[model samples]
Target: MGLEKFGKCLSMAAWMSLLVVYAYAEGSSRKWRNEVLKQVNSKGPYIGLITVFPPEETAFFGTGAFKPSPIHSSLDLSGRRFRIGKVHDKKVIYVRCGVGMVNAAAATQQMVDLFEIVGIIHFGIAGNINASMSIGDITIPKQFAHTGIWDWVNQNGTLDSNDTVAHLDFETYNVPKGGHNILGQIRYIHEEFFSVSGEPNIARPLFWLEVNQEWLHVATKLERMELEQCINKSLCLPKKPKLVVGLRGTTANIFVDNAAYRDFLFHSFHVASTDMESAAVVMTSVSNGIPVIVIRGLSDKAGGQSGQNAIKTFGPLAARNAAKAVLQFLKQLN
Candidate 1:
């Protein structure tokens, strides 16, 4: 064959290869979408919402609440489904991916299927462990600890309930020796919430206090135990999982106010930060291969509100601050 004909044949082969690669990429994306959609759209109504809160009057009714009225409802938008209520934007199809691990995962699956949420910002309230972080400060956790994912993913690749809660973290920040202070990196909201006359009356006496206290205590103890075990066993093992020392708590549970308890976590877990739903969010993202960013406001201090009402006053401020940080984060991604 002439040299010119050979060059043309090679060019044709390269073009064919490019087409094949594009086809495979598109097919893989579609397959992933279908898998996620099948599980989420299996049952019930689908809608998008940005924020969620338990049905409570105190924080819900607090001043400067940007959320819609009635706290929960459904609304129609331009070619999108949205759950009306306290969300980022009624126009943007936001999914109320509920609270806690299981609910969060289920809601997220549904959100992805129905709304096809390209990116998500799990913004809400969180407790502050670092003394420097005042109320209304934002936390963008670089590392998520004590989440149990690493334990379950052994070399064998088998699902084991025997594995403990996986301690996961983000790739954004580095672990500092002698501990790192989480104050200056993220956006800080300096504001206060209004003080209500009485305590938030819970119909069911805060059962979470007891449950959280026990689990909270065990989680810290067990995390330390696991870390120590990993360190001690590291010499004998060829490959060991990475261990991080930081605080990992949720936004919803309010048991974190006890100083002694927070102090216990500080001493035991060596945690520098705290948030409610970040771990669950991280876990879901990790499971689904979705990128997740969690930024929250310091609604309540680690200790009880000295004379101020955080749940009443700071909730809205915290929410707004979190929203701002999320917006900034989204902007930077562009």
Candidate 2:
């Protein structure tokens, strides 16, 4: 009886030891899967392409031969669809990031996590803030700034309002007198302030996000290439669109159709164009340490034009031109 009891105790000890080993192995496997397995499973190094709206998405898709992949995010609460394939012989993943900063950031983060993307490229239509820029003209901004963050200041430069400020101050690249006609060096102010508190109690440092120089070089080269000059016969532009590099881009949730605000943004931020999504993408990419570039085609003159809203008429044209530029850039990358 003593020997039998001893044997039973030994069997129980072995079973418990096996259970412990199995549990440890399972935990390690999960860890490895999370850290390394997805990377190995990824069909990359991919170039991520983002467009903001349906028209922009249509324009981008028209530029390349993309094959729909079975891969999709099971956790995509936004229900945004992702497509993967090739553009100019380089692997590409194309997705629509919706129409604003929140959507852009969410989609970008998902892309970075889901794929082994080497870089991100955002292309779409923007309201032209530069008076010299015409409809169909492409602007590849050197830096992106979130213009929504502002501290309401009095005429004396004191915080007039008691609003909470998220950013105490930030600096942006200043476009020169000659415009971003060349790949000029970026400049930033010493300090600028943004209010985070209604009581003017708190503020944080905000920095302008810079585009990857290597990608910027590619964009500069694209300026020399001829792009689609016409959208369609009905909406034919007076002149062929031209590409310009080194502009500053700004983003806000507001659709800046007001001429006064358009001029204000241009004068204050030295921005060539304003859009809704690029700034978010830039911030997201910066946080992830990924290289990114933004290519925008002028669809309208903000509120500078008095006759009618040009976006309704020229949006597709601008999107197509931007797409053409992006495709050319991808070709050069190959």
Candidate 3:
């Protein structure tokens, strides 16, 4: 053989070996998929998913730089690929679906096009309602009320039929084949009180429905009971994520600005927390048939600080907790 041919063959062998080594390095499970597997394992199927905004002020889903694909062909509807993951567990993925409705919808479609996610949870922070919710209270919302969609319902108790709404009742929405698991509650953390006249915080949960099935059948009936119990009991405790899970509130537009507007939301919706991205995440996740959960942390009261400051204090912490919750949920599902 020619000297040049032998050299080329040697290079090819060296490259292949490097590729094999890279796949097994430390923290190798960071990406989805692994050594191929055929027969279904004893563990449950994979559950592909995505998260929007989360606890950071970052945005995604609208950047023209990285558009998502129509669905990774290797994975099944359960979000499992033939040879993915070191443990053959419920494979999952996350997306920074940006804030608001438009971005969230785009990300949801991308997730669905790429994998078979069984459930979704829109998790994030929210403002306070009625001065009743304190910091670190987990609220599972049953409805999402967007003030932009309609007039603000007053705490004074005057029902106005003319109220238009950018918001939708999450509990009323239909979920797909598996239906989202016990989506009636939203987790929340209350912003701290700095002054004698500090602004009231607004915190709420995300709302969404299913694209394939009308309800998630896997949620044990006891799930609802457990969540509600946690919320009722959390009020007396002093901890982040008070664990109360039932009938949370949601909004459409960003309302963390003025005291009047904030108070209006508080009295009107009777919500306990508020944030910017959950509703969009919920709406889109439902439309695309991907189940998602949102976990938000209270960063500031409407006029508290610059965007930079807000992220600095709570951004990393919230993201860490949200990631942990998702991993725990995935383990429970499997």
Candidate 4:
């Protein structure tokens, strides 16, 4: 064949291959949507209520408040149990997403894919990093950021000035043996999340991921909503618990119990609560275009106290408060 004809044939072959790729992508997207539609027609269009562990579950599910449908009883998938139930006369799909960022993110995405979740309401306990906040208090944060991600520099590596981002110094824990302060510094960093509208597998990096504003507006109705301040009749919080809204919440995989780290978080990020999972849940839901909100009860001060951690004694109380707040917030929704 002539050179011109050969070039034309090659071009046609490339176009055919490109068409195949696009067709596959479209088919895969449609399949996912069709699956969600089928589930909605049969079972759902329900609100997704999520918690982290058993301790958080007791306040919402251990009692009779959640009535699980016999047909959808304990539908287990991906190491999580999704209970289709009713809470305060609103249809809800309740699930415990286990612990940590990975579990939280996986369960959230799974819930969105398997159920037609209109919105997400996640309630749980978190460590207090804000000095003004107290245990058993409920915080409905306006935004969430995954502060767990870090850029660890070498002992001798240079970093940008304070004008950039706050860097954590390890010199406090070390006596300089020589140069480099004996330990490297850590710079808190942002996370990159993919959205549906963005290019495939590419999304902008964000230091703080804002939650849905309409949901935040609805959460304002929870102001002055009562919280549980007592574990029992004798043991109660020194001060009555109050509902605090519009705080900033941060998330990490590591359980926070260090005083210095807590102070850094409070001062740098202005974070009210630090937990293992909130940001993961928020990011996943937002990526899927579903509005999500978090209700966290401050259980401990992230090692701000002098003695044993307060979580053991105050966790139950905090969990109960978060559960109550979630209920009241839901009542205001519809």
Question: How close is each model in CA RMSD to the real structure?
Answer: 22.1, 12.0, 17.5, 9.1
Model 1 C-alpha lDDT per residue in residues 231-292, reported as the tens digit of each score: 13332222221122233443322336665545544554454555545555554444444455
Cα-based TM-score, every candidate: 0.45, 0.72, 0.49, 0.84
Supply the global lDDT for candidate 1.
0.44
Where is model 1 poorest over a 10-residue stretch in terms of lDDT?
202-211
Query: Which has the greatest TM-score?
Result: 4
Worst 10 residues of 4 by lDDT: 173-182
- The list of candidate 2 runs beyond 4 A from truth reads 1-40, 69-78, 153-157, 160-204
Question: Candidate 4 on 52-105: residue-level lDDT in tens?
Answer: 988899877654677776555556665577887777888888899999999999
* Candidate 1 runs further than 4 Å off: 1-49, 54-92, 146-254, 304-309
Instruction: List model 3 lDDT by residue over 1-334, tens digit each.
Output: 9999999999999999998888776336533333212222223244444444534323212211122222432343333222223112445344555666666656666555543446564555555453554433344454454344433332333433332223232333444433443434222222111212233453223222212222222222213221111224433224434333344555555646555555555655666556655555565554443554544444334433333334344444444433443334444554
For model 2 the TM-score comes to 0.72
Please tell me which model should have the higher TM-score, number 1 or number 3: 3
Q: Per-residue lDDT for 246 in model 2?
A: 92
Write the candidate numbers in order of decreasing TM-score. Answer: 4, 2, 3, 1
Give the 10-residue window scoring lowest on summed lDDT in candidate 2. Answer: 182-191
**Model 3 lowest lDDT segment of ten:** 221-230
User: What total of clashing residue pairs does each candidate reach?
Assistant: 24, 16, 71, 0
> Tens digits of per-residue lDDT for model 2 on 1-334?
6999999999999999999999999898777646542543366688889899999888877865555544532222248766666776777778898998999989999888877888999989999999878998999999988877654432234442333323222122234333232222222222232332322544345557788888898778887777666666665788878999998998888788987668767876788999999988987886677889999989999999988879988898899888888888887784
